[model samples]
Target chain A: MIEKKYEFSGVLRFNHWVRVFTMLVLVITGFYIADPFIIPFYSSEPVDFMNALWRSWHVIFGFVFVASAIFKLYLFIFDRESENERISFFDFIKPRIWVQQIKYYMLIGKHPHSKGIYNPLQFVIYTIIFITFIFMSLTGLILYMHLYHEGLGGLLFDILRPMEVFFGGLASVRAIHHATMWIFLMFIPIHIYLAIFNSIYGKHGTMDSIFSGYSWHQKYFKRRKNKK
Target chain B: MQNRGLEEKLSKRLEELSKQQGIDSTKSIQSILDAKGFSRREFMAWAGAMTAMLMLPASFTPLVARAAELSDRLPIIWLHMAECTGCSESLLRTDAPTVDSLIFDYISLEYHETLMAAAGWQAEENLENAIEKYKGRYILMVEGAIPSGEESMYLTIGAHGTSGEVSAKKASENAAAIFAIGTCSSFGGVQAAYPNPTNAHPLSDVTNKVVINVPGCPPSEKNIVGTLLHFILYGTLPALDAYNRPKWAYGQRIHDMCERRGHFDAGEFVENFGDDGAKKGYCLYKMGCKGPYTFNNCSKNKFNQHTSWPIQSGHGCLGCSEPNFWDTMGPFEEPVADKIYNTVFGGVGADATADKVGIGILTATALGIAAHAVLSKIKNPQEGEE
Candidate 1:
């Protein structure tokens, strides 16, 4: 019952890193398009197209983000590897896990008895983050139509027009999209810190497991000590 | 400043053109154009300009001109509420001053406080007569925000006991269609900005009618004329966007049609006023230009007869044509901040604050974890391998 158990599958790890890379591209390019901080040249001819270039990158990556999100959603639902992740939703809402997680994060309690790969808080937070990613993708495309007049961007106009109105015009849509970016910005540091914290504190090689697809189960340490 | 000289120059040209066409201000459009002196080709050229401003095809020029000539004169009831009269002034400053002024002759202007010769009770009587005579037939044009608080005492017309809302409601009661002219009337312009003390409301919000918003600080002369002509010719309202603005006028962002858009796309920006970039006509995106988000044809349909626009004059857009622009599109020279977080954190500014605080928290977290690791290592030397 205690061994190096496979936690993240190759596909899940691929999706996770792809999301990270696309998000990085999106945030940098999006911010530049929102307000270009660097003035490469103040008096360049109109043909420079720097902002347009950033926008193109932003939009191109935007689709990649969308595709990755959709693929992640597909994997979440249909892939057997994600069955535990799906069931973690129930554990995430459990009152006992809530209390245990709070105590653990506060450093007052040991890791609670858990049946899922992700702890309750991680489950909850990741779920919310993914939901936000979906929203950001939709709103981002809605705002993108402002610049694009033909091709795939133009085709999406029929759909985004009504959403733009429902969201209270372009300004509000842009504001919401802008504000959500800060969420990801804040999430990255906390996410990295927690990953490293768990890896080092539990001696579980959790960080390496993302790439290696196997983690030394914490219970394996207890079983090995008993055998010794 | 320079606008004065531009206006004088524009008026002089209009005068000279009218002389060449033998147009008399006293005569109607039909009379002047039909007169032996005025050619059909000249009229067609003017029609073409209006068509282009309306975003209509070249083929629509003859159709628009024919409509202008054959359409029945619309009866208009112009009402002033909580406004600065800027919309009216814009109309007066039209490049083709003679023809733009002739828009009055084409419409039976039942009541106009600024331009009507009638004064005092005579004006009141004129309004009443127009309403009674053209009930359900005239175009009711409301030119400012309608104050709704404290019995609407914030704005009143003449010496009567009538508030703006009251008068607007009565006038629009039986009108065929209502036109909310100017940002104030259409979207509560400046009066409806934050801390709107007067409780100003746009015409659509105050009334249950199908209101058409010709929103601008003051819309261009062509838009005003185009909207009126569309109504006159088609006997129905032009297509409207979600904001109730005519789609042709407010369909696209100013950034799309801007002359300086090349600079914007090229990432060349004017960082400050009178800077070399600004002097050299660089994009004003960095200087808080709201053109990218603002949906108006100001670039193409330049104010004062295509003379200039805000961006052309080397200033960022105020986003005047947009709804709640005063409240939403501010700091005028800086991008809008995330109000919730900025205000919550005592307005230290955006992006930078988030970045600093984010980095600060992460650094503290790292140090705390490091210290904890060291303490644990001292107690249990094998903690890393545990």
Candidate 2:
């Protein structure tokens, strides 16, 4: 028999959807700012400012994406609502769990019991994604600092000048920013596929847990009942 | 005492050289200024301006004037390799010829292929003699990229057909300082862009010495002369940025110093050429202006004797001052992100942009995921068995 259990809290689900919305907006507007496919009417006055409009949206969502990512990171480290997420580090460190997870993915072994919400593979992938987010944010700020040289941009220029030099220059920083956006594009499809695969094969409410805060559990309860 | 001894030696040598050439060396700079109708007060104002441009104290105006007068004492050997003579032409072709350009003209340029009267065997002999005579005291200024490696044959100098690489290496060997005068000499300019048929490299790559890069398609006269004056006055290299470009001239982006910067912040831009915004001097950010990426004093020190620069003429900055700009800052009328990595994976055809590559990989990933899902469904006959 399947038992419904609370897996993600309200905060986790909120952060997840915020990241999803922000990423979508950021990508679309970022692409537009990069290429600006929309051209204004030739006879019309040059007051459209289509590029600037798209760029403003892009900058707004870029900040949102960074803020959401930071909140998620904070939750990962110190969220009292879900202490098990922090325990995911244990799964990442265990070689036996890694082998088992690989075997499960290859359809040669049963899914390894994870002490935390994520398996070893999931933990590692999430860690890398978070790091890429940080890199993307830094390169984004470096590019932004050039456009507006006053207020926050001025402060960022002073702080991030060394980082810009380290990456070679503004051109390299731009190239890196464009390249890292592809990382997100690559991750999204695979992430969705894996979530769907787990929900279908594992007979658990894995995909539903992202929308609702609960997932279905069975074996753990059976083992606990038998022990009682 | 040592400094005075060197000054005395320099003056005596100048007098003897003037006597040999039948020219008055004592009043060369002053006489030239006077002939050009530049008063002493006007010259002092120019000196003060130069001092400010060099980021020196206001008190150093007289020092700068003195340095300009003594500039002829310093020997400079300018070499041209694998480039258009645009940088030289820009310095030489001013309407009235500013004090800086005049100083450049007055300097003891021992052997310049463009400026020197000697040619062929005689020019080669002059270069050899200059290198021998000046030894470690003369400044070596390279005007273009050096074709290096196996493609060294692409740029051969003199009747002897010596490679530019060998010539630059030899000339810079005993030089007190080296100056890469243009983007070509600093970062291998246009010839080094994409495919790079001649395999050109910046002067710094060919020589073992530190080269001060004055990188532009043709850097402004002020920047060129200001760098020279800095070296002359301080007897040392000026502070350089990460790219070895003198920081005083290339310290800020063109976007920051642009007159239309207010429009940029106000969300006003020239959507097209000859538009109302363009006529009104709107920011050229949408017109693929590389001003944001380019670090140069073109806005502050306008080209053509401070008359107008690229932006002032309603054209966007091409980012000519940057390294590898021909490759990095292209589709010059579009944003940098529009076309990047022009020669990816060793020439995958020029049209292959970063976006195309990205979209291609993302499509393949989606296809792979679909195939994997189908295979998983087919292989797992006992559904929900776990």
Candidate 3:
């Protein structure tokens, strides 16, 4: 059995819990806002209460997204990275390695080909989601700008015209937003399922590692040298 | 001058040659001239101006020089049934140089219930006599839908015109070509909405005749003017849609042309009667405005002397121009479900707007982070080591 150790720090713990908190805010409120059928509350005004609040929350979380992205990017480019814990562009396409990472946990394979901070699959998905969130942020800003200044909105509209028309104009843009919620929703089950599975199979109790800023391996272990 | 020798002599001959449309055999043109109601010179001058008026942009001022031409004025019959006289009022309100009354000039206005001063038996006689004398020659103008529930007594044309103006059905059948004015006459209007008590139907539905429907609660006067002139000069139906109404007038939805459609796409909405949004003149659709579905020129042409319309009046359009609009369309409230889900109608309803997009982005990002946290915990035991 491989030895486990606690290596996470306090900053990583704060980052993890806050990230979870913000993500929950984004998902529940986001879905409620997209369809508005989520919760029913009587409103004295013609519009509902949660509806009015969604705007403030959305802007607030927009900054959350912006901060997380900047912080994560900073960590990727400049943080101390050991040879066994590094990310590379080739991780985007290595399907066999991803499946091997999965199979090792499924008990379908013997020794796991383990040597990195992020599993290749995890690295690829994160990279994609990071870029996609940037895209969402851009489009969201363009749409928000529409409310205040139409000239700026029009310029953004010109850039998004293909997306706008392809999605069938303004209506399609809305649907794209609404439909994207499902993407997050689908991610939840797979995310939780794998978190539980890897913790059990690896005997690492990995769930609170983000909150506590540490993960458990098998008590004590010999560290390897750099790959490059 | 030698003018009298040839030109002057020929002028007299040309004047004699023009007896025109109304010189009945009972009254010789020369004999009436001698009796002196309107002198031949004055009568010819009036006729000359009327002839010139046809090619004129659209005005009552007679422009023709004394050519002693002929009577191009077609015979027209205005028929009213199952209607408030609003369409007639719109016609009368038509811009000066009065296009509606000019329609009177193009066609001999032998009988009209609203315009003609003649009424009762006298008016009834005119309708009968005109329809008789100009059977296949005159055009019949119908305003308002024809109610089919019970007896023709549901509407009475009063005894005007020559034929005693029977039920709207009989009158519609006897006409040369029918011109159905107003949304009511063209598409049964609000009276024809679901659970229609009157069972009102457009003129086109009542008879097989290709009725030219000019649909709008009160269609724009310019549309009326244009259709009438086009018919007079060419004697053919203007381009028509499936409804048989002239397509030139009714081919577009109000949203396609509205000034505030920009606000609609951006998800801006007027949520109440006097909110800041309403004052801003944003889309009334959230208020159940039907501008999106209603097809008419009300927004473009405007109403009440071209000043403002429903959306401009701070209310959403009720889509009065569309068939059964009162039933199918809610006054400009939230867009229909399809608009919310499948369209750029922008972020669901007007109230939801930017928030929907914001929520969507936030969820995706959060889930990405969750997904990564879980995956990271799995890889950490060995992957973090070097």
DockQ of each: 0.46, 0.33, 0.03
Question: Model 3, range B96-211, lDDT digits (tens) per residue?
Answer: 43323333433345567877888688877777788777767666778877776463345544643222124455666667667888888887877676667767777777777788
What does each candidate score in C-alpha RMSD? 7.7, 5.7, 15.1
Interface RMSD of each: 3.4, 3.3, 10.5
Query: What's the true lDDT of residue B300 in model 1?
Result: 82
Per-prediction TM-score, chain A only? 0.90, 0.94, 0.71
| Candidate 1 Cα misplacement greater than 4 A, ranges | A41-47, A218-228, B1-27, B32-41, B57-59, B70-72, B94-96, B149-151, B336-386
Model 1's CAPRI class is acceptable
Q: What is the TM-score of each candidate against the true structure?
A: 0.87, 0.82, 0.46
Q: Alpha carbon lDDT of residue A12, candidate 3?
A: 48
Better of 2 and 3 by DockQ: 2
- lDDT of each residue in A133-177, candidate 3, tens digit only: 666666455445434335655566557645543443233344455
Using TM-score as the measure, the top candidate is 1
What is the TM-score (0 to 1) of chain A in model 3?
Answer: 0.71
lDDT by residue (tens digit), candidate 2, B171-268: 99999899999999999999898789999999999987999999999998788888887777666787887789999999899988999876665566
- Residue B244, model 1: Cα distance from true site in angstroms: 1.7
Candidates ranked by TM-score, best first? 1, 2, 3
Ranked candidates (DockQ, high to low): 1, 2, 3
